[model samples]
Target chain A: MTTYYLEYLKLKKKLRSWLGPIIVFILIMVAYPLTVEFLEKDLEKGFYSLLWISILLSMMFSTEDIFLEDFNDGTLEQIIISSSSFPFMIAKKIFIYWIMIGLPISALSFLFSLGITKDLNLSLFVIFLAMISSYIFLNLFVFGSALSLNKGSVLGALITMPIALPVLIVLGKSIIALQFGINYLELLLLLLGCLSIIISTVPFIVSYVIKAHLE
Target chain B: MWGLFFTPEDFVQGNSYRIIYLHVPASFLSQSLYAAMAIASVIYLVWRVKLAAYLIISIAPIGAIVTFIALFSGSVWGIPTWGTWWQWDARITSTLILFIMYLGLISLHASFSNYEKADKLLSWLVIVGFVNIPIIKKSVDWWSTLHQSASITLTDKPSIDPSMLYPLIGSIIGFFGLIICLVILSSYVQILKRESTKSWLKDYV
Candidate 1:
């Protein structure tokens, strides 16, 4: 418990790490309408695609240095020496990131969806989808960040982005489901199922990856 | 060789259908090679088999080339059959994703100069990226894509005629044998390069 709090405070101090993604998300959402005409329908047409991609890009940006700071400072090495389970710390770190970064992006996605599509019900559903997907993306990108710990984040993004493509496909389908009022729950449940698997496995795998880096 | 002259041409696709002999084996081997790499990765990660690590990188380039062949031949086959080269169908798109993944694995390994660290990271990436395999396999069934579902299966009677099926089976076996030989050769190079410092390698070479 104290570890989670401490990690939370630690991340809270790194303002750029948490706040940058939200600002980027806002910039993307705000900038997108300019490229299209003044028509509301035209704006709605590209909104979800832009929304999901912005969320993906934002998550990737946010995790670019998830482990780098600690790694350079020998904090990770110390954590490994301590008796605490490394994977648990990783999961908690990701959870705090979700609270700090993902939750806000998801909420903003809801606001963006509501503003553009003018559909409150659909916007409400977008919130849930965004929240689940952002968490999933955060976990995957954190794994990427771990893989390319000393190397730049671009290599990490290159390798991890393909794995996330399927999730993007699912997110696109979920939006269609929302628009049509069919099987939306099933799709949401599918995302949840994926989140369950990823959330459980990534931290453990990342521990080994970080260990490889340390070695 | 027998698939070229012996098998009768399809009435629908005519001569263009002959490309199937090349396309099927390449596509089949592409996925199979990744599956093999994934298994090797598992072995390496779990048991720390140095040979398994060698096998993973050895198989990556061959897998990429084979995947590219599958995509190119599929495009050629599609032009005549579907009246277009690419349709972004599930199978084709997933296979393209597979090709990119092969490149990604190779690049990830190359980015790190340390071979051992590279091997460990590459293995984990291979294992994680294995999720795309089943998606490629079942894409036609999972979605109403332009690509057709499998005509051949172990569980059911083969939908293809005996004449075409036999030659295709022969060609797939021949192609797979050739790929295995290539993989063996590649592994030899990997072992030679990575193990140059070891005394046993000097004796073996």
Candidate 2:
């Protein structure tokens, strides 16, 4: 537990360095819906879609830094050699990623929803599911980003997007369902299932790739 | 499988419908190749196996070609059956995305001079992208997509009649064989390119 806290602190410190600009970006994303709403009041659905789109794109942008810095600074090498297991280290990094990127973006999503749709209840639920699902999505993204650390960022984006299409589709559908007040339990279940699978599989894959690259 | 390949059949649309033989197998082989690449990627990542990277890269182009054939033939088949060139059906969209993913892999490889970096990156991409293939395959079932239902299953006999089955199975096997040959040939080229010294390459040049 002490070790976990230490790891968390280390990640939090690293993340704090990037938090300011990221927060400003989240604010901009949140304000997008207000602008769209002002431009066309009836464009509510479009505003909602745009909100999710911005969140997705913002997350993608923030994730580019996931491994690029580590790879450049040789920190990744040290992490691999640390007494802490590779998976634990990666999990901690992903946890930091979630806190820094996913949580703020989700909050922005909720704020955008309220601005556009003016329904606090549905907006909150939508944000809840979006946050949960995006955590899983970012897990997969960071895993891929870690894999592609030596590759350029654009290449990482290309490789990760298609793999992420299903998640996107499900998230979109669930959001739509939420808007319409329909039951989205099945979609949530599917997202959770996918999240579980990636969580189980990704650490091993990341460690393996890192080891392979080091050699 | 061989027994299923021995029967004969005719399509109501005549010989053109025979394209089904190519289309079905090409689609199947493409998906299987991606699946194999995914597994190879997993092995590479899990074991740090260099061989798996070679296998993944070798398979990408062949998978791209197979996906192309599947989409082209599906488009042709659509013109006859659905009276249009294309539909935003689940199967078509998924296959298109699959093709795009393959191209993405190919482009990533080409974009990098650092082979080691490219291999590691592509391997990771392959594993991550693999999650989509299953979803694509099952999309027709999971969503109200306008794609045809899956024809082959183990628990149930194929929905395709025995008449159509023989040629379909034969074409599938033949396509698989052809893809294997193509991949092996390409892999040899990659190996030579990667391992040969400048003098060795110059000798050939």
Computed on alpha carbons, the lDDT of every model, listed in order, comes to 0.93, 0.74
Q: What is each candidate's fraction of native interface contacts (fnat)?
A: 0.68, 0.81
On a 0 to 1 TM-score scale, where does candidate 1 land against the true structure? 0.97
- Write candidate 2's Cα lDDT for A12-131 as tens digits: 676543464356556766566456546546657566556555655666666676766677788778978878688777776777677766787777678767766788887887777668
Taking the tens digit of each residue's C-alpha lDDT, what string does model 1 give over A90-120? 9999999999999999889988898889899
TM-score of each: 0.97, 0.81
Poorly placed runs, candidate 1 (over 4 Å) = none
Q: C-alpha displacement of A151 in model 1, angstroms?
A: 0.9
lDDT (Cα, tens digit) per residue for candidate 1, span B99-199: 99999999899998999999999999999999899999998898889998998999999999988999999999999999999999999999999999999
iRMSD for every model: 0.6, 2.4
DockQ of each: 0.79, 0.52
Alpha carbon lDDT at B204, candidate 2: 70
Count of clashing residue pairs in every prediction: 0, 0
Judged by DockQ cut-offs, is candidate 1 incorrect, acceptable, medium or high?
Answer: medium
